[model samples]
Target: MNKKIINAMLVLGMTAGLAAGTCTSAFAEEAETEEARGYRFTWVNPIVGLEYWSIAEEGMAAADAKYGTDTQTVGPTEINVDEMVKQIDAAVAAQVDGIITMALDPTALGPAIQRAVDAGIPVVCIDTDAPDSARSYYAGTSNYDAGFQAGQTMAEMTDGKAKVGILMGGINASNMVSRVEGFKAALEEYQDMEIIVTEDTNADLLIGTQKAQAMMQTYPEMTAIFGTSSTDAQAAGKVAEEMGITDQYCIIGFDDMEDTLNYIREGVVDATTVQKPYEMGYLGVELLVQTIEGNGPEEQVIDTGVTMVTADNVDSYKE
Candidate 1:
């Protein structure tokens, strides 16, 4: 990658830490006596079958219940950018007050997002971002920092001498690429530990497993794996266990899914950085509602932060 592109992406990551610095609860009181304005917001996800969105839905429900905001969740059964854009267009046509969505591809969702913004409907991106789009705010983890932290942890565990491979959800996804960049940046000091291969999963578990298997077969000496998505990490652990090499390699993954947690508990996955999808969904709705009501928080980007879950803390997150 060109140095300029890398720097630009890093700057995009840094934007997450910049905010209006207003507390979320401060605006709750602002809505107390207002008539149930009943603003409707639709949350468009890339896919809805994954367990990752369950908590996010819960967050949306909480916000809706508390604020009387009408919320609807919609997405395709799989990663179809075309279907996602159609949904966005439908929401725009309906003139919904707000649209909360994840940008699976940076450019695929750009026009739909722009149309929404042009229609005076607020669009707030959560989970993944399309920074060039006209979205009002981004609420999610700093994927670069998440990847950097994972890289630092990998270095510590492998003594900076392990060969590493990567399992990614979508090769072109902005969030995934930024994570790989951050991971590479962190590993710069540990010259002996280098990324040997990166395989795309296309947001599919079976594909993720197949890629993980291929990576293991092609690089038998590989001592560590980085899963850039929830499915990728969970599938990597499953593949390693099926091959009976769980003890031979270390797996560091993103998201705290049940299988990922089990992998950590069983010592198959060394560690994972858990994202607060619940908060993303919850705050995403809140922010959009505020924007609709003219009391939106001053923060442009809300960094929900992440938790590094290991065997020691895995049990606690189970609840």
Candidate 2:
């Protein structure tokens, strides 16, 4: 198996440090909320039905229960910018106390976010972000940094030489793009690491797998595959294992989904980037509520931080 272990020592060390060092109030078990009574907030999820998004929804529910706030969760079953925009518009028209959303597509979601702010609704973007939008706060991972680490991790796993293929959820999504940019920047340090191609899966697992297979077939030299969306790594690893070429590729994924963990355990995926969707959702509500009460903090961004997961330490994450 050419599937080498990444610098497991480095990964473990960094993970241990990031566990405490990346502290932000948002990651706290409870972000401070005071008298949020009668404040009805709406959380707009771009992919409401996907398993990944469900974690964020759980966080929203936890925050709602803890703070005694009414949060209305609404979105399309699939990732639909038009439906998300319509939902946001509806929230604004309904005059909800505040709104929460993820910046799946900055250009498409930006204007709607701004409109909500212009209409006096305090908006918070979680998990993903649209800095250009009028969102008052962003509570989630700094995607670029996460991607950078992913690139570095890949370099170690592939011994600093790999024909890389990147699978993204959406090419136009700012957060996903940022991860790609950071990934490219990190790989620039290694002269032998080259990105051969990038494909968009629209965050669909089947499409991701199809693209992964296609990329492998086209770029026969590709030694590493990076997935910036949750399903990308699963796609790559699944294809590699099925094609009997898992040894030829070092597979990296985003987020710690259950199936992804199983892949790591089975020696299919080398590692993955772990983001706190639940914490992001939980913190987003508090940020919105704070802004509603006119006590909004000066800092507009509440980074939830990110960490790396690998086969060596995947068990720790599973529990």
Candidate 3:
């Protein structure tokens, strides 16, 4: 969509919490240094200190090294929508030139994003999306497609027949929802493939493990496990190890986090879908800078794409 259209939309239902988020001094400092050095962009995440985000920061650093953009990564210590919204608000208050963030919750994050747009800062969504938000571009996996792929892989591994369980970090995340939908759709082709349960781990591996164990105990006939979160598969795998049932059930995980990859290498996880975190960071910065300069992104959605990893290709992603 054009800037005029988006701006008009923002003006129509501008959120009431226009100035609620506190803009911290760190954001202010980056804004202050912009003119003296280079364009400043903030990369905000729903949860910080994850290996996934760290890898993404590597891409951000690469973009910074190449484009000379001053980028900072910040987010809540946990998966809190309020903090995500506040960070965007903070960015706007600091007058940051651009924003790169995942649409953790559109209902909340969307308005904050619209406010940032109203303030003239370009916003880009990465790793996940909130199509309802005011983000100008998205650089990440086609989450639904990734899920469909996982489903197909599981079906093949299980010979198109298995009782399945789904593990999700959070139930409300749009990306996870998309994955679940796509996974279900794919499994429809196999009448014997059933998703018997959906567990919400609240992004905690321990909870995920407990949930996985509970699901397994509650549904002992379950023959497959599908994890929609980065560490869900690992959690399930740990449970399988404890139960002395490794390689007995088909386990599909998400992302290429180190442990997930290690699981693949060790033949614990049957397969995993890997999203390009680095490219999301690299291209997010690229798109944000391009939008800020008015040079044009020329495209709004950039699918950094997904890859399925197994022992066959696990060696390359082990690091």
Candidate 4:
């Protein structure tokens, strides 16, 4: 071969070998990238200290393990809409792959939720929903149905002739409002039943207890006390216990928190509606994952059924 042709041929061979090596390395890196990094999901509840919220956290953790993703649960110590909005904002700032939240105040959280959605983060509302917000899905119990059930149960327990009092978180919350309305509507069917006192404790357990105490004193013939929220239920139960009226009054509460269950077992609470909070949390994460992968269902609302738990059925709820 001529010297110039030999030199050119050698350079071409070396260049081809280097290109081949680079291609192999790139392919290996791509494969590893897919295997190493999974999706990251964040869940924000209205309150983290509550047992019902912990059940939701449990479901979220299960989903995280199944999907091999980093999942986190953060929320306010109490039901503070402002704190929840701040947490949502921080989740967006952290650039999580997806966010799931419980919208305590549908109106107040709408803008923050929209901001997260606008930032390209998939947002799902669990437990409570912000219908006007940019949330992709809502996974929770049918609040109206749950409330209706509560109403029916309360009516039966009170024999449709008892005077009732209501303890609620807020009138503005759709979930609380739905329960109150359903209870009222059901009670109206029975002409003998009357709801004389309704009070909003603003999500304060102490305030709820105080309100319940006042109502108990004001309506000396109050037959039953219904709590629309978990904290309110706890307050009513505590007040009944303190006033030595557990035997005389019927207490029906919402949510099957530990204390609530104990009250039922002790006969302080006649019954409570047990919402599937853990299922809500689990389904929310699962839906977010499917949506991110473009395989989720188009359904906007997911109804996790509710159960009525009383001392008779409290054994079934253990663990």
Candidate 5:
């Protein structure tokens, strides 16, 4: 073993170590790229087939297309909490990367949502929130504030004094309950504007019509009606028109449904509060992706904002 032979062997050993290190680095980079492209997410809504939920679904699709996320939506055909719970449990069993859901019944859905969270799946609530659950964030308009906005508009339409009836959808829904509470809070200042009747329509347009008519009959001199949901609001207007008293009742409602907009244009509804369900659907995906990637928002609740639409702005929303 000569000294020159030993030096040549040491040089060869150094070269082999460098080549192995470069190969390892390339493999690590490839693995990272694959992980980036493979993230999957699922969105769960309380119920499907509603125009509002359809809009939210559109937003989810937009986000999926833009971000290259493998996203899907699951929901019940009707407002059934048990069905929604089953959908969520299935998502958890499948081990999705993340979940976005509208908690129709916070208390009932809390345990299921918590299980997802405990399993290391990030959860975000859109539209209706399960605040008591282990959700990481909320992306939607404040129901209470939206209701307050509706109430304020109602006060202006009736000149702060009128006999009013209330119509609502899915009375047990947390969002609807908050909206009703906020509406009542707003009217507390208007002593003369009495709320004569309040009823739930089970989110059915036809039922809303019957309830609205019943309210009118119960409060024969009712000067205004406030609907906490789109169907409820539109029904009040339709009932007034059918009863040939559209000119007499001041109707206000929520959401920007086509029929609701028509009611506004025809002056049957004085105004309606519009929510950004599109934003909720879009941002829900964005935030969940962020959380999964460790870049989520610091805030717990994200307000998507609300708009009050009357005849003045009704034309813009018509299509």
Candidate 6:
């Protein structure tokens, strides 16, 4: 072979070998950098079967579809604080990518939430909040604001001079406590309005009914009643209807439940403050997805907000 041709052939062989080495190195780097990039999330609510929770579930499902992530929902059947704590611990053990919880007892669940945080899992609270907990964010209604609105509506319905009673789900629940405080503060603005009794039903509809009935018997002059939770509201309305005082006593309630809406339509409940549960759930998941993707705020508290729903606008909220 000619020297020129021989030299060109040798150079081509060397060039091909270099290119092959570069390709192999690039492949090895890509293999080394491969990572599991999907996420698993958990949504914990106080209970199921309530309309509010179903709405939240819808929002959560929507998020799961949108983000192509696996999501699970679990919680206590009766808003039991211990049960909720167990669920949280289980989710942490499973090493979920994120957690969304509704705290029935803020202090009780703080440690468990902190444990999840310490484990490097992101936690977001929804529907209820544990401000002192290790949750990265809160997405839900402003309970205090809802309660204040309920109080103002109650005062107006009672002509500002009514003796009032309050029915609460549980005192341990921070959301309910904030609501009661806001209601009381708003009622205090009316010189003639007074909260003569406050009772806890443990979030049982039947117990709420019994306590409300007993309160009515004890306070015959009561002209209005406020229910700080869905179960309490339904019980208060049912009790009033059963006692033939539905028309005489103005009932103000919190959270939009089907029963509450029905009572509003029948004039049993004068008004209720409706929180956007679906939005709360949707935003909670959206925030969680952002956090998992490293695109969310370090700490955020989103107020889904509340609005007064009464007979005047009950039809508008029907669907």
- The digit string of per-residue lDDT tens for model 3 on 53-135 reads 77777667666766778899889867898998888999999999999998867777888899999999989988787677778
Model 5 lDDT on a 0 to 1 scale: 0.77
Q: Give the Cα lDDT of each candidate.
A: 0.80, 0.82, 0.78, 0.76, 0.77, 0.77
Assess the local accuracy of residue 58 in candidate 5 as a C-alpha lDDT between 0 and 100.
Answer: 64
- Mind giving the per-residue lDDT tens digits that candidate 6 earns over 223-315? 888888887778988988888888778888877778888899998888888876666665677678778778864336666567688998887
**Candidate 5 residue-wise lDDT, 110-186, digit = tens:** 99899999989989898777777898878776888889888888898888998888898888988899998888899
List where candidate 1 sits over 4 angstroms from the true fold: 1-35, 317-319
How many clashes in each candidate?
1, 0, 0, 0, 0, 0
**Candidate 4 Cα lDDT to native:** 0.76
Model 5 residue 209 CA deviation (Å) reads 1.4
Candidate 3 ranges with C-alpha deviation above 4 Å: 1-37, 317-319
Ranking by TM-score: 2, 1, 3, 5, 6, 4
The alpha-carbon RMSD values of the candidates against the true structure, listed in the order shown, are 6.2, 7.4, 9.3, 17.3, 16.4, 18.2
The numbered model that scores best in TM-score is 2
Considering lDDT, where higher is better, how would the candidates rank from best to worst? 2, 1, 3, 5, 6, 4
Scored by lDDT, the top model is: 2
Model 3 clash pairs are none
10 residues in a row with least lDDT, candidate 3: 16-25
Query: TM-score of predicted model 3?
Result: 0.87
Residue 177 of model 6, lDDT score = 95
What global local distance difference test value does model 2 have?
0.82
* Candidate 2 Cα errors over 4 Å, as ranges: 1-36
For model 4, which pairs clash?
Answer: none
Evaluate model 1: give its TM-score.
Answer: 0.87
How many steric overlaps does candidate 1 have? 1
Quote the lDDT for 275 in model 6: 77
Off by over 4 Å in 6: 1-37, 297-299
- Structural similarity to truth (TM-score) of each candidate: 0.87, 0.88, 0.87, 0.84, 0.86, 0.85
